[model samples]
Target: MAWLDKLKALFNFELNAPLINITKNSGNSNLGKEYVNSGEKIDILFDNLSKEKQEKLKLILKEKVEEGSKLLEEKSFGLLRELINFQRTKGEDKKVLDFFQNLIPKEDFEALESSLYLRRRFQEKRDVSKLKEDIRTRFGDRGKNISNLCTAGYFENFLMPLFNSSKEGFDNIYNVVVSRSPMAIFVHSAMGEDQITRDIKTGLEVSKKYGIKFLHIHGIGDQNIRTIKRCIYENKELFNYYDKEIFENNGIIIVELIL
Candidate 1:
């Protein structure tokens, strides 16, 4: 026990480092492996660490469990299972979960659900003409093209909240409105003038109504652009006034577009 205490003290300094790699035969390697492999069921591993390290690691693990519990409450058990499976397959490491969970917040998960629903609506809505007619009647044709409208699964999930309110269902309205625009007609390269022009046009419309502008800083593929153009051409009424030249000057480079 005295030797174990001495060993713990010797490696105690590594606890706070950004990363600590332990080999199988390193002083505390066996203990580390034991804790990780024990189904997170063993409490003895905590006894080997210094008080400070124990407290820090405990807080981290507790946070992970709490996050898992929250996911379970939301009925996102698949995600919870994925997390556990990842731990089981990769060898249980509290640090990995700690880092990953920190990257994703609860709001992000909820937004993902909203985006999914919006995308599904886009696919299911059959009467393109009626949808465009309805929108033009409400918002007026600010050069929007209906056919080119498509919902961005991930991007919309993240940026929707910044410009719209949840209570008013602004995100849903915005998604519907944007999908029908000519700018939605192409996947503009973030740096390409074509994409920038579309984004600027959309931003202007959004700003005029909501007093907020959404800058599309990312670039997309030519294939996607072609697809959007095809969608727009099919629904001319939705894109009658879309401007093409304005975005060329303002489009950001592709590298700069990632969040």
Candidate 2:
């Protein structure tokens, strides 16, 4: 009750509110978790609202849901989940999804986990050439929800900061990720781990060869660059951030080019 009370009073619409008290436990360590006081207050709030106000609020929220539906097509949701996981892995935006964990249905949670499990099993045994060929033959870039996932972390992190700190990096990211068939980047560090061993010269050469568009580097190992070479790599969960990989001596590694 106290937590929700405090949260309700925080005045979330304001942009410059001091968030210093966000971490505090509402002056009670002994109280049990208050993930929510209950939906009763929410019902009460709705009940107290004037009919006109309620209608306006419903319209506002309905519009948002409609907008979200347009954005979250099946394929986009999958890729979006991956990017969000990657961003969190880099510690970029935290606490963004904490509020929604409980809101999601239990069946949805199970289905998502099950789907990931199945995909991982398939990815582990994937043959990039054959798989790409099959994708070409079967999908041919014309499937309703198929997508291309890429990310050049070396260019984004090392080259961008050193060479064009102002806007090139941001623009490139936006074009490749936000635009270009609506693909996005920012993959697991394991995919881009070679940024350590690679020099700028090599990076430029590879970037130029690969059209400067980074494919989601599944992972790197022994001498394999997964995406450009093969394509079985690693991944984390949608929200849990679990490290799932199949990095054998001959596994995914497009992030690192062997010179």
- Every candidate's CA RMSD: 17.1, 18.0
Per-residue lDDT for 1-259 in model 2, tens only?
A: 3333333443233223322121223234324332222222221134334577446555554564555533244455555666466544633112212322343344433322333332333455643333333443544432111222312223234333533444554445433332232222223335543442232234334455434533223333444343323232222122122223332355444333222
How many backbone collisions does model 1 have? 13
Cα lDDT for residue 2, candidate 2: 39
Instruction: Please give, for residues 136-245, the per-residue lDDT of candidate 1 as tens digits.
Output: 45444332222222243223332344333453555434444444432232343233445444554565565446533232322334544444445445545534543222
Those runs of model 2 whose alpha carbons end farther than 4 Å from true positions after fitting are 1-41, 44-156, 162-216, 219-255
Q: Residue 243 deviation, candidate 2, in Å?
A: 26
- What does candidate 1 score on TM? 0.23
lDDT of each prediction vs. the true structure?
A: 0.38, 0.34
Among all candidates shown, the one with the greatest lDDT: 1
